[model samples]
Target: MQESTYNNMNAARSSKRWDNWEGHRNQINRILHERVLKSSSTDFCKAAIFGAGNCDDIDLNYWLNNVDELWLFDIDLESVQQGIERQNIDTKMIDKLKLFQIDVTGLDKISFFNDINQMLKDSTPIKKVVSYIRKIANNLEVIDDLINHYGSFSFVASSSIHTQLLYPHFNQMLSNTKDKETLMREADYLMSTLVKNYNQLLLNLVKENGTLFIWTDEFELSSDRGNLHLLPQFQREILNSNYTFLSKFIYNFGLKGAVECNKDLLSKFPNFADRLIDKTYDLIYWIWHYDLTKHYLIHCFIIRL
Candidate 1:
């Protein structure tokens, strides 16, 4: 499957190392070990990681030690392949690894089941056309493909990929959508419903008794004036004196707007909250931090189920 233009850009972004790798990665790894993996009731031998883009952002040891067989899924296969090569992953782990190029937006679903490294290198516009033409696509094949070929995974990690599924389509709509009221009302409604359904579908796809991990950006905050710097307690703690990520948005619900961007997501979630899969707060956290780069505030949700 072909990746959207924005996704390709994001994958390219991961090619560069973080400015504060020591501090940023250290905190991230500590959270994976202390909050996520350590709290798991099951040691998943067979696992699948969604949005496993350039695995630079992940703590490799978590998968290497816990999973015997690992499946990596992403919009761009080249990014993940490069991630694996960059990590110098052991040959044994690579042997058990499977990769798939997929887009969960129902817009794009290309299965390079044989080799993820091989992808369609069409222009961004053309790829989007192909993807948009398949807007009603169902990705049940993604999980079924995994099970049929490699068997079921005990765990699924949707690491910051959900919101990204909507980026390209949302942009396309916004650009073409002329009516201001339509942009607010119609766009908001579409985004809210899509976000809710897309998220629930991921949970339903998991095998029985399987654990799922979902970490994503919740909201973005920006001030017209450049004097906003207040952050939540957790952000202050994890990134004490660190300025690596000020306001980087990865996965986002199609809830962007001119104002009330934060409350927009909250207001939308309530409409479909009842339809969501039941989840426990075993390891869940929320943070609103200053985005030094974009000069925005980011609300992030880190949860394990």
Candidate 2:
């Protein structure tokens, strides 16, 4: 990926997400309140977030009072800047806020630095936009660099980024290749390995005994009437994946049974249970019925450790 890919985000994308956050602001804050603030172990002096873009859903005031520093990370620096400005925070308060523009998944590292340089030099027609991504598809590798760099956080949170593991890369491959079926085939072959490695990366980012709160909206189910339900399943899927595969590797389960992830065959990464503080965890799977059609099953994991 180009340095530009590493540095910033697409303006349209960052703008649209910010707009979406405005409509979702209240519900997001409400959920954070219940899951994080209500938790007895939510206090921390400094913290880092992987998908802390726009900060629309982040609990700024809580951090302001409890934390001495708050690090906001995203692929888009502009979105982070918008979050800082939206807070209307004072200069002294702003000093505690540090912005990191990065794609935690590691393959997407083309920064705004690359984009600006390409424009200044007048590169090929659309190479600046398309080339970096094409390179990414071919250059993918296992990554666990978050632990090497910003490894520790008192409290870690994921804002709908886990299930999005392969989505962006999948989309980019579709766009660069412009053949959906071909891209799908490639994804079927490539994604499991990528996802397994990425999932490991996510877990390793947590500290040895820090609190982790992950809320993800994935898993869809359909009713008899043809309506679909978007349910949450990060923890369940992870547990199932771990149970299915790690059992085979570590416990030597029978090979007669079959299980799948994303309708693809399943394999396990390291189980998260080994990382839990007391292994006393709570998983809240509840639907946030915003309207008749826009119901989201929020998969909330309150893991102490």
Candidate 3:
């Protein structure tokens, strides 16, 4: 199976040194333990994380030591290795970390990247492009090698990858194309389809009564825009009230994609919330201080399947 071109592009764009994101890593680890690991009675014998890019957002040592085996899945395997090396994890625990170079979207199986490139080269009409996207999304099938061999995992997580499932590739493909309005409409449909399927794949990989942790980078706030400085106050108010405040903030800042990015994951709640252990507080929100310049609005759900 060919890897999606966008995955490789994403790997290249990731920073080599993760020293700056220590706080974000710690925050992620703390939440996983509090919300998914310690609260549950399930034994996380074999755990897997999709989109384990560079493994920076997670606590490698804790997972390696706790789980009987830790499976890291990403389209780029090298990033996983570099992550381990960066952490200076003990070599003994390293054996527990299994790596799978796989695309969770299964786009490669249908030749999505190749097809898009060919379509662009041929100057395919917007109508045909929309049709192609719908066809591929409808026929999508995610192949899991781990299940047949190792069976379902005891614990599973998706590391803020839902928004990434389609947008980057779509943008890369339509960069030079016309008919923005039509393409955006089709992109929304394709993304909705992909998110549903991707969510199912995560659930399928979990054993009965196993815990699944999923999060997404819902929106971005940048210091460059001068509003990131307000996060300290805004976060408290936003959380104190409902998320309705978020829309106002977005409008004030003229930030694009926040609403759609948030809805991408939030909309799935009704379908999947039945299995959620603590619906009252199952969803957790935080700020991922990505760097000195940018922070991401992140929300996570802890589901028991």
Q: Candidates' lDDT values, in order?
A: 0.49, 0.50, 0.70
Best by TM-score: 3
Ten residues in a row with the worst lDDT in model 1? 112-121
Task: Give candidate 3's error at residue 228 in angstroms.
Answer: 2.5
What would the per-residue lDDT of candidate 1 be over residues 56-126, giving only the tens digit for each residue?
55656556766677788887788788778777776666677888876654434433211211222222343
**lDDT score, residue 103, model 1?**
61
**Candidate 1 segments whose C-alpha is farther than 4 A from its true place:** 11-16, 19-28, 39-44, 109-151, 172-185, 221-228, 232-280, 286-305
State each model's C-alpha RMSD to the native.
8.9, 9.0, 3.8
Candidate with maximal lDDT? 3
What lDDT, from 0 to 1, does candidate 1 have?
0.49
* lDDT by residue for model 3 (100-197), tens: 88777677766787787788788888689889888876777656644573336877888877766666766766676676668767777777667767
